[model samples]
Target: MPALLIDRPTCPATQLHSARRLIAEERLHTLFQPIVSLDCGVIYGHEALVRGPAGSPLEMPDALFAAGRAEGLSMELEIRCALQAMKDWSQLQRPGKLLINMSAAALSQATADGRWQRGLGICEDYGLQPTELMIELTEHERVADIDALRRGLTLLRRLGVGVALDDFGDGRSSLRLWSEIQPNLVKIDKYFTRELPAHAEKLQTFRALLQLAETFGAQLVAEGIEQPEELRVLRDLGVSYGQGWLLGHPSSSGASEAAPAALQVLASKEIAVMPELRRAGGSGITAEKLMMPAPAISDQASHEQLYRFFTEHEDQHAVAVINAAQQPVALIDRAQFISRWAKPFFMDLYGRRPCTLYANPSPLIVDADTGIEALTRVLTSADQRYLREGFIISRQGRYLGLGTGEQLVRSVTEARIEAARHANPLTFLPGNIPLSQHIGRLLSSGREFVAAYADLNQFKPFNDQYGYWRGDEMIRLVARVIGAHCDSQRDFVGHVGGDDFVMLFQSDDWEQRCEQIVGRFNELARNLFDAEALEAGGIMAEDREGNLRFHPCTTLSIGAVRVAPGRLHRAEDVASAAAAAKRQAKHGALAVYVMAA
Candidate 1:
């Protein structure tokens, strides 16, 4: 949908002709996009992506494919690209999986003694195991003959090659197809994952799809997860596999050295203490180290003790009744203590004889080894709502003091808040606070870096027309697109607010990332607008002359600058230079201008 001219001649016809020449010349290349394991957070494998000549007219791979299809040379170009990708990938084959793109039409297109079989045999000749290969089928293309497609897929599967249904939900395929040709994996379309956290419907749809994937015995991958919230939610939903710009971008070699700074999750000391607690059975001690004092119910002991415990320990909603053996047998409440215990019935029955209603009817017990996750669920259950009043705590058969639900939640909430502040809210990037420290740390250790500044073109006018609610959503969407492009590289991105953002990357791949973000943002944003607005060329609105005028839609402009040690002393200086260059780029259509300095 987005057009990019990588190395087009001055003339349009000549440009098309050049693309044909490049393909026929077999000057195309390939790149690898790493797909990491979500569980252990390690690089599991890489997806092989096609690329054209260094200065070819087809700059972007998607644009190249579109051109190839239009020229009726899709299969030829695809085969050449796949072979090149495999050859490029073979040089760096680690103990990782290799994913290759396969067009259904290409595979189903009678190619027995043809190039397709020859390519497979070549892979075998190279000693690449079929099990190590994963063929990803395109969802946009029509499967002219389902039976033929199935037969080819079956043949590949029998050879131990894995089959993945790419962009599963973006197409019109049904549950019937899922039941019939169950894929080894389903890559959820980025369209669904991009705005999942903010959009409840998308989140629910993803959850349901995850269930469907699990039901069909297929591994589910939540693709296009570019935001921290989206990633966190997907992890919580138990989607076992994932791939997207957020996880990692497609690279030429597929080997990545580090996780992107924004994605680097900081493990808390308290989290480390969890395993130690488990090993020791449980955290037997609370903040107050002293044994929990029992609530005195004696007629002489005033309600002051009960009130103090309740107010002081916000965590303990329910008080426990301690027996002479120092073990808690029953739990009590302040209300029960006042209405039932302090009643004249106890004094009337006898300051000497035993009273019946002083103790609660039903009490709940918990062991020391009980985990926080299970404990939270148990306390929240209807049957155990009363247990939140106070639950009996025990360790190795020895009774400990009473604990309540209030304490645990407060602790967990505080920990989560501390963890979330590591990134900026607007751009969802590592903020100035974190970025400065990271830069200082890297600089102090003598690491080289490059800084880039990105800004949106005509965003204010678009926001004015769309209203702030949708405007905020647009900003968020663009942030995700930018963040997605960064992937898991050792990069730093931050929001200077509004339609502006910044990134610090080590490699020269910043331009490629900028191009991808701008292209994808325009495509997706156009789709988000109404059909009438899209048909109007541009939305009509009041101009400065008080007449209806159509304002141009928004686009992005990015500026990149090198951050060599002596050249750039501070991050802000580099950012300032980039911002100026970005202003120059805004005068054109989504361009990346490099700072001469």
Candidate 2:
């Protein structure tokens, strides 16, 4: 075959003119690529990439900036780029920070030309505060004046604009600049991320960088991540933020709204592996465990192609339609698409057209790390169309796969039923089985925690005089009070049957939280009795030996045991300590006794 013909600008002058015209007319466009949080499976921010007009000589970012630099218009070009990026970002209304690139030279020039204020004005016009924007110094040029740069950055910081040092570890001066500026974020260059898993020395260097970031309290973002192995290494090393082709690419119109696929892959791996490593108890299940490989059709697929797909795979209830970058743009319901095709002349009229022309443009997109309970709630509250069409599961906003409503409902139901089997009947809280498992998992993970055992004092007499139904109501009320006072994110509350309960607090504020629970329970306990009993502060009831006596109202006694890592090897050890503390607490009404060292 003959060589393929390609078009190119014939002269250097023409390309320069194009670059100049691009600046004069303000025709530069901004594209945004997502920066994702690997652990959470969410988009943390987006880095804006500037591109010239399609098919233009300055279309590529490096060429665009280099052309302007050669023409002595680098400062002007960068200012215009920032303005355009801010305006478009405001219009797009994305949730995270908008990271705009600026070279160190441009920063000095903008401050000199009074152009930085105009940039701030543009931000104000779009209802964006400085806090929402991050100015990333590309660090391609040496700092001409360290004092001047520091003064400019200080001003930006005062206005709530965060500074990020980009291309870290690329030069000898990178560390010096980092110390001088003390930026809030640092982006590691792609060289270290490339083939990271195969290079042990590179891993060690990355680990050192991570430690450096920690010392300065700056977040480290690994850039140019393109492979699964690279992502795995980054995640294992505890890298906080990441960006690259493996996550999502830049889009001219705006940032690609789809989640990153790497997040789903990492989450799936965690769901499959982490539980096994800590399965001394029942493992906490995530949505990824229930997720099946998403059935997907390309966004460019013809109507006939979709029809054939549905015909061949009769079991497929729905399929995600994805763009060229593997980002899901729409979802097609199998039955609905087939029903339309079943109409007379449907194939002849639209068979050759793209499937996207007829697919549902909006589908429910969920992160793979979403819990089963949370997933169930989202699906139940969704529109009927989405429920019928199924939903797309993403990692950080990139498409991973599709999940059917049937699968979600079934998984949630099974999880709920299994939980119900181990739930306390009175308070409907997790019973002894789950409580033991929760403590076991925490111990296995080597986490320092406080385990408190709560028991009701004078409860036998209160139950005898107040009937079992009333006593059950009191137990439920106590459960609610404890739950209200505990940190839901870091604490576990369980009912160990009868009037006994267990609390596992992982937060440093566990002491204050436990005190609050004790105080609140005492205040609410009086309300459970009648007016006479409330005034007297006790109810007359028969003792175990058949003697009549005045019994105080039911009071809570908490026995707390602080379990340090390596101190206790099993849940039962912690339980024994807490039980001993409980014995001490029962001597007084609404008392809390911390176990002695």
What is the lDDT, from 0 to 100, of the residue 537 in candidate 1? 57
lDDT of 1: 0.62
Tens-digit per-residue lDDT, 1-597, candidate 1: 011223333443335434455654555677777676665567767778787765556867877888888877787666667666666676776657787887777766523324555666677666666688787777534767788788887877777878777777886655666677788877788888885655657766877887888788898766776665566556545677667777777777575532573145311100100000011112333322323544433322234544455557665456665556655565666555445446666544544443224556456666666654455465456775453365667665446665655665564455334333445444455545555654554454344565677887666666778888878888888788876887442466666667778776754576788778778888877765667778875677766676777776766778777656566666566667777777777766546877654
Model 2 regions lying over 4 Å from their true place: 1-17, 253-260, 269-597
Best by TM-score: 2
Off by over 4 Å in 1: 1-19, 110-114, 171-174, 256-263, 266-597
* Per-prediction TM-score to the true structure, in the order listed: 0.42, 0.44
Clashing pairs in 1: 32-251, 33-250, 260-488, 315-407, 318-389
User: What's the true lDDT of residue 587 in model 2?
Assistant: 68
lDDT of each: 0.62, 0.77
What is the Å distance of residue 13 in model 2 from its true position? 14
RMSD of 2: 21.5
